[model samples]
Target: MLLREIQDEILRLKQEKDIAILAHSYQSHEITEVADFVGDSYALAKKAMTLTQKTVILCGVRFMAETVKILSPEKTVYLANSSAGCPMAEQFNKTDIENLRAKHPDYTVVAYINTTAELKTVCDVCVTSSCAEQVIRSMPQDKIIFVPDINLGTYCKNLVPEKDFILLDGGCPIHASMTENDVFKVKKQYPSAVFLAHPECKAEVTKQADYTGSTTGIMEYAIKSDKKEFIIGTENSIVEHLKYKCPDKKFFPLSNNFICGDMAITSVFDILDCINGKGEEIKIDEDTRIAAKKCIDKMIEYGG
Candidate 1:
């Protein structure tokens, strides 16, 4: 079957089944094209809450689908590709964070939105890559314990230098793998292009970027900027998406290794299968959901 045929079927079935589809920015263009909304995980989750559909499908990873369930508990949420799971999200578990909390009793616990919903239950606040700096700065605490993604934690810590941050050894393997040399090579290849990186990247990599932001933030910046060329430092898919969005502008990947295998695993077929009731349904206990929501609610309060 053709790609468009499957997507058309998915569109027809989702409407027939009263389902809303949320595709993350990292998802394939075909999946995003058919989605009701396409953006980052937290934004997608918030969008789900405003949606009228009783059921939703997230064409992303497991934790992203879990976030949707946490936000809109009344709606049924499914991960379009059951095996698509973010390695960074699973890097730190509930117990690991609990142990850190025990050691830093006076510190505020900030969980990145990429974390498992279970981990958020123990967190004081949640933040996305776009709002981490602002959220951390807004906190009244003098010290903070950031979990799961040390790279993002470091990036935020640098932005809000007044607060003491305890960063552990955890991050997106794909982003962490990039080095200063990779940035230099890319910059050399495209001297005229501005470099935009995601905060999940290593400090060395992010420091070299002309702009560091969330996936959506990077896209918006590139679209609005007058620059004719850009080297996207996150997932390779962004380069492709940007090319389609701004045909006149040239987009290059900072490194071919920037491709996320987890995000790549999902396809339009997964969304079709999900809408047909063949995907993994995300489930969380009432207590866990409520507890996890507090952190996210705090994010909205502080980020706003």
Candidate 2:
């Protein structure tokens, strides 16, 4: 079947079956085009809670699907493609943080929302790339242990200097793959373009960027800016997404290697398989679910 035909059928079946599709910003345009909602992982999870559908298909990755289930425990959630997994999300296990927590007994443990549900159970609060700085600033603790993404932890540390942060040697390989050399090379090519980077990038890369933010923030900045050209420092898919959203504006990738194989693995066919009951269901034990939600709830409270 053609892409449009698959999308049309997905639209029909989702409505007929009372299922909502949540697509991450990193997902392909074809998947997002047919999704009921499209946004960042944390935002998509929050969206799932407000959705009236009893079932949800997340066309992102394992951690993202788990987040939706964490927020909306009553709703049945499925990861469209079971193999779609984030390297950063699975970078560290429970023991790693547990060891850190054991060492820093008085420090608040902050878990980035990209983490797995099991990891969040031991966290004090949760944060997204957009809200990490704000949430950390709002936190009463003088010390914080930011985990599984040292690049983002470094980004937050720069913004909220009052708190002491313990950053682990972990991060999104795809985002960290982008270096300052990529920025300089891209800038040499597009001297007039503004560089907008995701916080997941290495500090050296983000330091050179005109703006550093989440994927949604980067998109919003590109859309609102009067500037005609932008160099996106996140996933390469954002270039395609921006081109479709702002045809008048030109978008360029900071590096061709910024592509995420995990996000790319999910396709519209997976959504079709999901609607036909072939996708992997996201299931969390009651104990883990409740334990995991406290940190997310803290995120809303602090980030709000």
Best by TM-score: 2
How far out, in Å, is residue 186 in model 1?
A: 1.2
lDDT (Cα, 0-100) at 215 in candidate 1: 93
CA shift at 85, candidate 2, in angstroms?
Answer: 0.8
TM-score for every candidate vs. truth?
0.98, 0.98
User: Could you give candidate 1's per-residue lDDT for residues 20-124 as a string of tens digits?
Assistant: 999999988998899999999889988999999999999899989999999899999999998999998888888888888898799889989988888899999
State the RMSD for candidate 2.
0.8
Tens digits of per-residue lDDT for model 2 on 1-304?
8888989999999999999999999999999999989999988988998999999999998999999998898998999999999999998899988988899899999999999999999998999988888889887887999988999999988888888999999999999888899899999999999999999999999999999999999999999999999999999999999999999999999988889999999989999999999999999999999999998999889863
**Model 2 spans > 4 angstroms off:** none
Instruction: Give Cα-based local distance difference scores for all models.
Output: 0.91, 0.93
